[model samples]
Target chain A: MNTLGISVDAWAAWAPGIDSPNDWNAWLAGDSCLDEGVKPNVSFVPPMYRRRLSLLGKMAVLTAQQCVDQYPIDSSLRLVFASRYGENARTVGILNNIVDDGSVSPAAFSLSVHNAIAGIFSIIHNATEPSVSVSAGQETFSAAWIEAEQILWSQMENADRVLLVYYDEPLTGDLTRFTDDIQIPFSISLMLSKSQSNGESICLQNKRALDSSDSSLNESKLNQPLSFLRLLLSPEQMISTTTSNWVWVKNSANA
Target chain B: MSDLIQEIKELIIEVLDLEDISPDEIVATEPLFVEGLGLDSIDALELGLALKNKYNVSIDAESEETKKHFSSVESLAAFVTSSR
Candidate 1:
C-alpha cells in the first residue's frame, strides 16, 4: 500500500451510460449491458461559456461540476486534468483543413490544445488555482493520481484538496483499429484531500510499485478509467490490474 | 420589421452555440460585447467569417465601421443588406 493515499471528498464520473452517481451505483450492483446515449445536460454552463466546447470538453466540465456540487471544496483548490488522447477529432479536422487549404481555423487551433478543457473548467468555476494537465500514454489515470498526491503532499499548508478530472473520447482517423472495445465517451472528477483518516472511501492502483502486478483482473487496455471503476465494484478489499503493472490494495492513509 | 434582422439573430445564436436562447430574446439594439452579450474579440472574428460565408459580405475587420456593424442584430442585418 502506498503511504500517499489521499482522501476523496467526493468523486463523480460521467460517460455515455453513467449519467448519475445513482446510475453508476446501480451498474455496480448488477447489470448486464450499460445502456448508452445519455448526453450531459450542461445547461449549468452559461451559453456564452459553452460556445467552443466539444463533447469531451462538455463531459469533463460537467462531471467536474457534479463532483464540486456534491462536496463543495475551496474554489482555489489545485486542479489536475488528464486524458489519454486529448481532442483528437478536432486536431484531425485542423490537419485536414491544412491539407485542403493552407490555413486552419483560429478557434480550432486555440481549443485543440491539451489543456483547453482544464482552461474551460477554470473559466466556468472562476477558479484561480494552479491546474496541471497530464497525458501519459495508456497510463494517464495512474499519472494523474501520482500528480494529485504530489500536489496534496507538497502543498500541505493551505492547499488541502486537488481536483483530478480525467476524460477521453475515442481517437479519430484509422487509429480506431488499435483501441480496445471502449466505444463510448467518458469523464471522471475526484476531489482528493490531504491528510485524512480513511477506510475504503477511496482506493487506487499504484504504478510505481514493482512486483505489484495483478494478472487475474480482465482489464480494458484502451480505457484506463474502467480499471478504477471495476476496482470500485469489486467485493474484495485487494485486487490487481490485467494490462498494467499495478496493484490495488485497501486505503492505508495515516494522518 | 426587417426579416433580415431576425435571421441575423438566429445566425448569431446558432454560430455562438447559445443554446436555450431564442432569436426573439436577443434585443436588436444591445451591444454584442462586454456588457450586453459578453462576446469577445474571437467571437467578432468568427461572426465576421460566418457573415462573409453566409451572406457574401466582406467585413473589413480592421476598420472601425466593422465594429459598428457587429454591434447588434439590426446593425448586422442593415450592413449585410446594404453591402449586397
Candidate 2:
C-alpha cells in the first residue's frame, strides 16, 4: 500500500444529456453525462475575472471554487491542473484572427495556452505556492496522479498537504477530430493530506492500468469530472482493493 | 434627451444581463456602478464594446473623460448626443 492516499475530493461537469444533476445530490450520485445543446450560463457568474475568461475558464474557475468549498483546505495549499485539450476554442479565435483578419487580440493570444487555467486558479484562489499544469494525451490520468504523488511526497517531508485538479472539456470544430473519443465536460479535484480514518484508503501501484474488475470500470462512465468525483464521494468505492486506489483520513497531525 | 437616455438604459440592461434591475429603475443622476447597479470593471468593458458598436462614439481607455462619460446612462447618452 502506498504510504499516502487521497483525502477529500470534489467535481463538476457540463452534461447536456442530464438535467437536475446540477445540484449537489446528483453530483454525488454520479448521474451526469453529456448529450447536446447544453451550454453554461456565464452571466450569473461573478464579474472579477469574467471579462478575461471564456466559457471554459469560467467553468474551470467555478469547479475550482466548488473544490475549495468541499475540502475547506487552507489557502496555502498547492494546486495542480490537468487537461487533455487546453483552451482550444480560444486558440481557434486567435488563429482565425491572424489568418483571416491579419490581427489578433494580445490578451486572447496570451490566455490561449494550456497553462492558462492553472494561472487563473492561482489568481482566483490567491495562492502563491508552486503549481503545475500537465497534458499527456490518454495518459493524462496516470501522469497527473504521479505528479500529485511526487508533490505530496515533497510536501509531506515539509509537513504539508496538496490539492490536485483534473479537468477537460470537449473541443469545438476541427479540434474535435483529434479528441472526440471522450465526450463530456468534466473536472475533478482531490485534497491530499497525511490522515487516515474510516474513509477508504488504498495504495496505487502500476500506473499502466487497473487489470482487475476495477480495470473494467469506465473512467468516463459518467461525465468527465463528475464521474471521478462520484467515486471519491461514495464511501463504498473509496478503496479499490481490486485496483491500486485508496483514500484515508488520519487523525495524527504529524506528517 | 429623456428618450435617448431611456433607450440606452434598456440596451445596458439587456447587454449586461441585469435581470434584477429594470431600465426604468435606473435614475438619470444615479451612478451605474458600485453605488447604483453594482457593476464592476468587466461590465464596464462589455458596455463599452456594445456602445461603440451601436453608436459611433470612440472611447480610449487612456482618457479620464471616458470614465466620466460612462458613469451613468444619462452621461453616456449625453456624450453620445454631443459626439454624434
Candidate 3:
C-alpha cells in the first residue's frame, strides 16, 4: 500500500516514572527508566466508575484525557482502543476464582473483557459516536492506527477526528512464557485527524519493498508503542518497527 | 451484632473499593444502593459475591428478600446471622 498520510493533532503518554514530555525525552536518551509497581493516578474519574477500572484501563483513560486536554475536539470523535493482552491480570484472577470455588467477583468479571475500558471511556465522556476495540497480537498498535485512519478516511464528513489509544501491561503467571516483548505497563494516546493543514503530519507505509533480512535494521527493545513514542519525541526522520508478519515504517512529513 | 455490622461495613468498603470512605462513616441504617451511597446494581452483585465467600451465605439474586438483605449494612448483618 502507498504511504497513508495522517496528522497527529495531539498526543499523551503515561507509564510509571514517565508522564511528562521531559520524562519521555529523558527515557529516550536512556537517562531514566519506568518504575515498577507504580500506577497512574486517575483521580479525575469519579470514585464510583474509577473503582471498576484496572491499572491498564486507568493508564488508557488517563492518557486519553491528557491528550484531549491538550487539544479539545469539538467535532464528533471516534475512539479506537488497542491492547495486545488487555486486562489479563484481572482475567487471570477471575479464572482462578472460578477454579477455586466456581464463583467470581461480578465486578472483576465485568471489567475483565477486552472492550471494557472502551465502554468505560464512552460512558464517562458521554461519547455516543462509534467506537472500536482491537487486539491483533504483535501488530496491535499499527492495526489500531490503520483502523483509525480508515475511520477518518471513510467518515470524514461525519467525523473529523479519532482518538487512538494503545495500552498494555506485563504478562503475569504462566502467561509470561508466551512472548519476549517488553513488559512495562504503559499507554499512548494520539488524537489523529485527516486535515494535513494543522498539527504534525506523518505517514505510515508498509515496508514491503525493503529486504526482510536487512542487517542494518535493529529491533527495538521497547515495544511498538514505546518505539513509536520515541520516534515522536525525537527529531528522527523515520523509524521502522517489525511485527510478526509486517514491517511498518513511520515517517515525519517534515522530514 | 454491632461487631458484625462493623465487619460488614469494612467488607463493603473493601470489596466495593470505596477507597475514600471509612468504615465509621458508613451508617449501618442508611441505604447502601442508590439514593445513599449511590452504588449501582453491579455493586450489589459484587457485594453478594463477597458475602457468599466470607459468610457462606447463598444470595438469591432475583429474590425480593435478597434485595432487602443488601439494602444496608444492618440488613446484610441480619441476613448473615440468620444464615449462620
Candidate 4:
C-alpha cells in the first residue's frame, strides 16, 4: 500500500544460450531454438571470484552482470534479487553429505543459503547500497517486481533506480522428486526507475487468474520468468500470467 | 610423484569448480590454502572426498597431520601415494 510507483527502463535475461534480444525475439516467435548442451558461459566472471558460485549462482550472476553492463547501474542502485528455489543442488548436496558423513562441506554450508548469489554480486560490485532478497513460492518473480515498486517508494528521496533480478534452477538428486519439472535454469534483471525513462512503462496489477485449474496443470510448466519475458517480447501490449492466488498482468500502456 | 601431483591438481580443479584455472597453473610445493591457491576449509573437504573417491584412500580429515597432507599439491600426492 506504500508505493510511489515505478516502471522498468531496461531489462535483460540469460538462459543457457539465449544471448541477444533478437535471439529472445526468435524464441518468443518460436522461430528459433536453443541448444540444450549449451550452458551459460559465465567466463566473464574472473576465476578468483568464480570458484565460489554454484551452477545456478553462476548463471544468476552472469545475467545480473549482463543487465548492469547494458544499463546504467552504479553504487547507489538498489538491488532486489528473488528466487523461488535457490541453490537447491548445493543445499541438497550439503544435506546428503550431512546424512552420509555426519558433516557438510564448508563451502556447501556457506553457499547453500538463498541470498548467496546476491551476496556474491554485492561483493563483486562493492555496492553497499540497500539490497533485499525475496522468496515467494510460485510467485517469486512477481514478488520481486512488487518489491521493486516498493523500492521506489522507499528511495523517494534520491529517486534511485532499483535493479530487480529473479533467478532459479531445477533441483537435483532426490529433491527433484518434490519439485515440478523445471528443466533449465534462468535469470532476469529489470532496471526500474521512478521517473519513467524513455523505455516502455509497463503496468502491473495483481489479481486472480481467469482459470484456476490450469494454474496447477503444467507438470513441466514454463518458468514464470520465461513467461514474463515472452510477454515482454510479444506484440500484444497486454498479457497476464497466473500463480495460485495472484495473476500478474503486464500492460505496456497502463499505469 | 609427478603423476600423483598431476592427478591431485586435476582433482582440485574439477571438484572445486576452478573453471579458469588449469592444472599447470598450480605450483608443486606452494601452500594450497589461503595463499597460493586461496582455497579454504570447505575446499579441503571437497578435495578429500574427490581423492577418496578416485583412489579409495582413507583420509584423517580432522587430524593435525592431515593439514600438512593438504598443504600443497606435492604433499597431497605424497599422502595419496603413501595411502595407496
lDDT value, residue B28 of candidate 2: 81
Per-residue lDDT value at B53 in model 4: 78
Q: Model 2 clash pairs?
A: A186-A225, A187-A225, A195-A249, A195-A250, A196-A249, A196-A250, A197-A249, A200-A247, A201-A247, A202-A246
**Candidate 4 DockQ vs. native:** 0.49
Error of 4 at A10 (Å): 1.4
- For model 1, residues A114-158, the per-residue Cα lDDT tens digits are 999889888887877889999997678888988887777784535
- The TM-score each candidate achieves on chain A is 0.84, 0.71, 0.88, 0.83
- Give the alpha carbon lDDT tens digit for every residue of B1-84 in model 3: 999999998999999999889998898999989978888888888888888889999989889889888888899899999999
- DockQ, per model, reads 0.48, 0.09, 0.81, 0.49
lDDT of 2 by residue, A1-255 (tens): 335554443444443444233444464455444445665544544554455566567666655666677665464466777877778887877777678857555456667888887786676666777788888765565567667667766735352556666766778776777763455665555665544555543334443433355533433334333434455444433222222232222222323
* Highest TM-score scorer: 3
Off by over 4 Å in 2: A1-5, A8-67, A86-136, A155-160, A195-255, B14-20, B33-35
Worst 10 residues of 2 chain A by lDDT: A242-251
- Global local distance difference test of model 1: 0.76
Per-residue error for A108 in candidate 2, Å, reads 7.4
TM-scores, all candidates, are 0.83, 0.63, 0.90, 0.77
- Rank candidates by lDDT, best first: 3, 1, 4, 2
* TM-score of decoy 3: 0.90
DockQ: the better of candidates 1 and 4: 4
Model 3 regions more than 4 Å off: A73-75, A197-199, A209-221, A244-255
State the lDDT of candidate 4 residue by residue for A201-249, as single tens digits: 6545544423445443222135567776776676654444444443334
lDDT of 3 by residue, A1-255 (tens): 455677887899998989989998997777757786677899989888898888899999999999888766454788899999999998888888889889888888889888999999878877777889999888888889889878888844477888999999988766889967878788999999884643356666655566567654445556678878877877665556654433345444433
Docking class of 2: incorrect
Every candidate's chain B TM-score: 0.93, 0.93, 0.96, 0.94
List clash counts for every candidate, in order. 0, 10, 0, 0
